[model samples]
Target: MRKVLKADSLFFYFFISLLWMEVIFRVSVMKQSYSFGILISCIFVLSLAFLFFFLCSFFKRKAGFFLSIFLLGLSSFIYASQFIYFKFFRTYYSLYSVSNGGQIVEFWRDIAAFAGKHSILLFLFFAPVLFLIVFGKKMLVFKSCSTVNKLSLACCALFAHGTGIAAVYAGGKAPNSAYDLYFKNSYPQLSVERLGLLTTMRLDLQRLITGWSPDIELAAPRDSKYIPTPAPSDKAKEDPNERETSGKIVEYNTMDIDFTQLAANEKNHQLKEMHQYFEQVQPTAKNEYTGKYKGYNLILITAEGFSPYAIHKGVTPTLYKLVNSGFQFTNFYNPIWGVSTSDGEYVACTGLIPKNGVWSFKQSGKNYLPFVMGNQLQKLDYKTMAFHDHSYTYYGRNISHPNMGYIYKALGNGLDVKKTWPESDLEMMEKTIPEFIHNLPFHTYYMTVSGHMQYSFTGNYIAHKNKNLVQDLPYSEQAKAYIATQVELDRALKYLLDQLEEAGVADKTLIALSPDHYPYGLDMKTINELAGHTVEKNFELFKSTFILYTKGMKPTTVTKPISSLDIIPTISNLLGLEYDSRLLMGQDAFSNASPLVIFLNKSFITDKGKYNAVTNTFITNNGKTAADEYIKRMSAIVEGKFHYSAKILETDYYRKIFSGNQ
Candidate 1:
């Protein structure tokens, strides 16, 4: 065997491993990444290898080689696990998500199942490690050089890191530098596309150690007069799906905001930009639909793992009735974000994007969340409460829900439900309804658990309980198992409806329900089967049901490109609550201010078209692509929403605005 550490030999093994990792990263993540992105990823991997090689080279060659093998093997495992995770969950993990890493431990069995399914891909991915271990150990060589050579190596590492950042930064475009590209994009799936997985993880680790904020100048829209307010009605050119203008003037729900004065006195430049931005936000005009359910008792649910597939007339009559007989949102979606359930729940409840890496809801317990249904309704003297069917402390809901102005309770606390793999949603309804059903003007929020995954009867209590319900369907076992879980959710809804009717509050209560996310744990084959065919993975897979109804109400259909993020603002608008439209990342779907559904990856669905940020592709609904300028403009707005949403959370922008938290 050759001496183990020739300078080139060390670099050679390091790079071979690094390059293979990149290929796996690309194949697994950045499959659609542009040629430029692939090139940038290559440079990033090389830089990382150089830095690690130099740092570890200070030790004996034997130690260095061993360390190199260990790290390379570890890298292979990381890439493989991440590949499995992304394959199943359809999202990537970030450093921020690691804080909530406890959640993943609960799904170890599911993770293992997924890993086993993708074993072949993983085997190929790690094949290079075997080569490095066998051929590398025998053929590789290294020798300690003079101080001059050591210093030169040190400089080489520095140059590599520096050059890599600069080159990728240039490619990242403004607002998203290489640092932002790698660390703060909030969309890890996209980050892995541009930066190799190792580079992205390295950046993520840096961010975890030293919290990062996007490096962008505060900007005001070029034309401040372009407020998102409705234009004068033109009946001759009405959209086919739009409610015909009654030849009446539209008015806005005017908040007593003095942005001009606020901006003038604002000393902080960031706050000033926010004030300016809000100043120009076009207030969605109050329409006939506004306050349609004002003063009504409200029961808002963030149903876990819900999808349109959950609604079947024969199997889930309650859901089917509500979906067909209420404000059925045809184009609604619940985009899966970084923290899908927690973040999804946060978005629905707080109308804010869960800041990347932190539980925004749990963190909100420390802030003044003024617009949550529990908080907003409590102001109207409604007895507000929130509940979950899991452990009271799971995801720190005990802290977050109460902060949302609810008298919060869950499995371990006030609510008494049997301890099972997943608790019963119906039992929760049975126990909690009496406490609030008779309390007139009450508002209750539920973060439901019945529809949660591990889509098998054996692993999921709700699925097992309702397995026979979906067994007759000509669907795959996994598909049936997934639907069985939702049947329990359906039964839960049935219990809720019966309680409301018995209490004579069925018509008086406004019920709003949407999923925390689609059933991601289920196989895609099952997903396609449920969808009736293969669906567009990006937009359609995220498409879901948002149920808004009051008993005996006329069914109204909305076709706007709306999302879960828009739920709070939409409900607030419907309930006649005053909020600044500009400050919110999501616009009211009922507003004339253009519907935009933002996704985790910064892609968007608007009324006119869809923009896939990963592929950098714009596909118009009309089949003809829109102007490049239009796409760029839409992309900017999407990017702005992401940047400011995170900023809003980090800075407690709401508290600062209302309560002087600055």
Candidate 2:
């Protein structure tokens, strides 16, 4: 009995240590500090140990060995399955639901890429730990067993199996609170169905080996597109033909849609009115500025969390110069997107609005993505490349970038940059510019991260040498800290411009600057305080600065409400690239399409007025009565945009568009 106790204790200690090591690895890589409630993890570790001990005591030696092998194999399989599911299939599953057929292939491809990239590290990290857990103590101890001992071991194994199965089933129904917290906070987009399946699968083997399952509901796939219709209690009794052909029917009570309750023909009339508004708003191309800087290098920088507020006379001279001396957009606005930062980038680069509730960039990986500047320039025999100073895999940029027809490079995977929480944008510029300038007629897209949010001193500190310049700004410590973060970003931009000038590509390279999103994490009070007034929370609050600069071109300011969505079409027009009008949801800001900025909450802004769909209020630059006709018109445009965005995601819209079939 004492020998058994000692062996179990050793096993528990080893397993707990391994778990802790994994925790430490996660913390170090994320650079996030531990706060309170670490003791809960300790308790969990102890609980696992207790269960391990009970199993070892009940099972015979040979039976226990087989049980351990089974557990290890099962866990490995589940982990591998998750990687495969996420990579090849864009859809994730819970224990309760399955992904669609299209998503299944996507999951497979993602796994292949991940495996190809990290197989060696995976084997190195897991193999030694697995070997130690299974075989470490075997070489040190040997014992012979009798019939009684063998029978006892078999009973223990059976008990372990029963407990594991129970645990998995229980866990599927109701996961541990701690696990739920971690899952929700870290991976918000993970479907409940996938979570349930994983919980069940993970616990089943553990419970069979240990003795229990966490009774939890297996998560099922959430049908975001499902619109429920009101039906009789006994829906099965109704004739199928009675249901509307345009609408899909679902079983769950939550899926019920009250289509009959929709406001009558007035809504349709309003939609048509909005479509008319778009037609009335004409944006003519400037024929006077028709000189084409053909075959010139073009550099587009989408700075992270960049805001118009960042532009100041003394603080950001270069930025101010670009804003004042170039073709600056005064009323330019960037509507906050549903997925926000990276998603906004997806819209700007693809010239398509992102669908709500999913990462468009990740979804775009499956279809052909057209890049007006990169792909079109490449066709013109231009060297095209895209650079990002962060993990390319975070938003699945690895897949999306390549699909954009650019030779993509990012930190850790393809490019070398300074190692920091958010890698230095300056370092990225220093390393990448040489590769880009060697040849003429190149187009490079850069996604910068130095201006990311969580605007406190610690969060925004830059590792560059020019950090001292921001100390004299007349602002609060927090505000100064926020500005300091952008200091590096500003410096990075200045450096790139200088390099272009030195290489004599400044005149040849057309530079465009736009923000991915407003710095939302910063205190609104601080922002308002800095601006010397209350910043409107509607569309204007979300407005961003846009700069289009060429060395000697006459600066022309346009007070148009253009969005990131217009970037591709606008650039295409500027570069004289021919594209089918039907290919993009956004029109050229300089073209005949009415310019509109869309917000995360489904509101929109245009030159005429700002419409808040939630409040049903229309506010114009000059205080005027609500224009019912204008409101209806804008609503239809927004609705059409939503419909198209969804269609693009569900169907292969880009493929059809690029192939000239749509």
Candidate 3:
């Protein structure tokens, strides 16, 4: 009996150790919250209790011990494979292109740093639990299982694992279809076969991963001015037989309009009035620095999950500097992109509206992306590079980054760091800035991860030690915790600015700071607590900050409403890049676009005031009522713009517009 108990203890110890190994593997890959560990532990404990009770009722001790060992080993192996697949190979099969070496290195460094910070606690929590399982009497009863029962249990475990593996493989290979299948099976109430049919037609993940290799045909380059014959004006009044014969006999060709033509069209009366309004509100461009440094380098940082709460008067001085001294956009709005966090990056960088229910960056991998600051500046002989301190391939950014014309780098791909979960923003700045700064005429984009959500002490680094600082903020505990995470983001920004100054390129470098999106997953109560009251459920609540700081530029403010899509044309004009103004859907708010034609669902704002398309109501802040005629005209204009933007993306119209191949 004593010997049997000792053997059982050993088996339990092995089982718990295997479980800890699985947990560590998952944490390294997913960066899941510590709460996941607690949940896993609960599930594991229950499984063990079930096993022990079943074995003790009928089996002998020795047999149970062998059976438990086999189950433990098998489960551990299966869990480990999930981590490996998710961490390394998952992105290769995604629609987005995979990142190269430098990018992966940058991501890995953050993961290492995160692991170092939590390793001690993880070990302490897991070690004793492992020991108790191995030596505890409950484990000894499992050793008594009969051979037949043990084999049956092992087969059941193997079958369950195979099913899980198959499901994961199928889901990864055909995400949309698998998603539809899951919804149909698990949520019949929400599942629609028609919706699935629509989605499945366009969602070809396999084709996206492999890319198109269609046969190429070279043709004479065409210009936008080459217009096709217009349809007869009297077609509506013509006989049906005449129309049918005409349609059958000859195909009608539509004229393709180029960006230049589109811009020219927008130069009409209404747009001219809108452009005038923008010029009146445009801030003065300041060149406070007299000397011309080699050439200006631009650094655009889109911090993930960042919010205005990160900005404090004293706590974050550099941010305060940018907000106060640079060309600060007080009413700049970043509308939530369809995919939320990363999709917002796509919109801001590419100045393209994301497609409904699909990731624009991923889908647009095959489309021509013009006006990307990185791609645009590259034409000026600038060495353009992009950095992300997380997995380089998330959201298919590895592919999209190259398409944006950046030589990309992430934690695991190239840049080395000390931690995981989130690589230190400061470390990314420290390692990558030197490579580009010395080479003058360089533009670098950084996507930061330190401020990501899951605002709890164990899940986030900010809440680990800095809770005391925000404890007195007039917000809920969760809100305060969210704010605390930004401390690291704040510190990283200050460090990057200091490095630029130290490198003597501060004046020549333009730093554009923008949040990827509003931090939305926070509870409404928490958001309301932070806002000091309930926030309006409309578009304004989703608005974010945009700051463009060029060292030694005179501080000015623009209060006119603007979205991130405007950044491209705005910055291009500011930098004096000769991009055709018409090609971009977003006009330089400093150019011909209205102060308000911002599109969300439908166009919400017109020059006259805010218009709710659904309710067909217009409200002016100045208390001036708009005439019925003006509302009708404005709605028509908004609808026209939406139709044009969609056509531009769907038909690949920009290539002809900008390339003079209309």
Candidate 4:
């Protein structure tokens, strides 16, 4: 028994340590209900650790000892770092973020605070290393393994890996299943939960290097359109064909581009397939709201970490007025994307789902984005400009915004705002409004920065600046700090409205605003305090307010479910812009088309029901029944949206179709 222990001690330590880290990570960072995939992840982790063991066995006594220690330390650091990162950001750190992440240095203060708060868990991760250093020499044999032994270890590694793969296949190939994540798709958070972090990172690096993209296939067509039946007490109607009852022929928000002809002329199979797919998509019908704000000056703002909880009448009265007044969308959402702010901005401006693992906005810098409001309105002789309150080059907005047809400015280039940890949104509005407000028939985009993370008075500049105002709030310090930062945003909006009114364009201008994401920096407990109840994680966590306000506009409320993804198309239709609604992943909210709000994990909410992908269950609205067939069809549609959205980024599908005309 002693001899056997000496011979295999190193391997056992590696395997046990790796398994321990995986379990710890699963419990803490990946705090989701797992399935058989959890077992598969364990086996896969075992196989990887075994491979490390086998490779380490090739070294001599001294080298082997230090190598094992190095491997163990690396494993500990990866798990520990991911734990703190997820806790801090409410998302996993992707390899892409790491590669492009010089700005991460700015978050060192927050990271240090996180480390201090979670020191126990952080110490537990490194305990294995301490054990190896203390007792490794007495128990672990560092002698080089014989060729025969090496061969056996290698065989065991391969066999275990093969078994894990087999188990994954046995789990099934349904959408978001273990098999789909492993072989076809890449949803980073879900992938980490199911496949283990190391395997997910390996796949991410492989895809990144090899230019691999998710394989997209067309879903089977539905037998009939899903017309949701609203319950008796339901105020909102859900008829799929319900629209304005004017005695006029229905015209769709479509362009003159012949997709069928484009597909026939295209040689690339993927581009052809995309053209064919979009050609068959049903275009949204024009309604009474269409052209309601035609030829209006536009100011689109992607507010930082804004939510309905920030809509207090006393604190953020401007926000309250705008939200409650013009084009009130009671059931709106601002779904958190993988890349958070950049992805949210991409979705709102481009009407596309962000491609996972990479900065889609940066990627789109190189692609043709004819659909974004900036580009769409630019062609009509509108003076288009965009501003950000932070660094111009942050998230590569310098590249992406210009490609969107905006004369872009941020901290480094032009638009000088006071340099703080997070620059002031109010200052940005004050300075940039003058740049474009006087330019008649203009469209400007503002990416606000006041409501950024590290939500505390000490670390957050904006929060500290407005701390006195939130001092009397009956909530935790973090919650108050978050609200205080949003107060800055409220003031910024007030300034914008005043300026517009002064310029005699407030009535002629349309101001549309939505958040980049929810205040993920605040914990659920703090969020609950602000919300006055437990916020439902699946759907309600994302329920936010979308403000489409113009001076003297009617306070009409629409109860259809919508998301930031629908912002571009909704505004495009309302402003009477010529855009093919079929090409966008989201439909015009004012149109008769059924509302579908897709979350990051492929969970979706439609007028019919809310489908939670994690639980594989659907909850119908107002106790209305949804047939299994209906759920399956909606799931397929969601899957297609994800798949094709990625494909558009990969192939630059829009540029392929309209490159000649432009």
lDDT winner: 4
Overall lDDT per candidate, in order of appearance: 0.77, 0.58, 0.55, 0.85
**What are the RMSDs of all candidates, in order?**
4.6, 14.9, 14.9, 4.2
> Per model, how many backbone clashes are there?
12, 50, 46, 0
* TM-score of every prediction relative to native: 0.90, 0.58, 0.58, 0.95
Model 1 Cα lDDT, one tens digit per residue, 246-344 = 665555655556676789999998888877766654556667778878888989999989899888898989889889999989999898877778889
Of 1 and 4, which scores higher on TM-score? 4
lDDT of 2 by residue, 391-510 (tens): 776567888887777899998777898767556888899999898797778899999988764455553346233346667877776666667677777878889889988988888888
Runs with alpha carbons beyond 4 Å of true place in candidate 2: 1-291, 463-467, 660-662
* Candidate 1 Cα misplacement greater than 4 A, ranges: 1-7, 28-34, 61-66, 116-145, 166-184, 215-250, 621-625, 660-662
Candidates ranked, most accurate by TM-score first: 4, 1, 2, 3
- Show the lowest summed lDDT stretch of 10 residues, model 2: 220-229
**What is candidate 4's lDDT per residue for 1-662, written digit by digit as tens?**
98798688787888888888888888877556476867888898889878888988899988988988898898899889878877766777777888897356778988888788889998889989889999988888887788999999899999999999998899888878889898888887888877888888788889889877777568654334542211111111122222333554456787777776888898888888887777666678888889999999999999999998888898899999998889888999888887888999999999999998899999999999989999999999999999999999999998899999999999989978889988899999888887888888999999999999989999899999999998988889999999999999999999998998888999999999999999999999999998999999988999999999999988998899999989999999899888888789998998888788999988999877799987788888789777888887777778788889988898888887787878
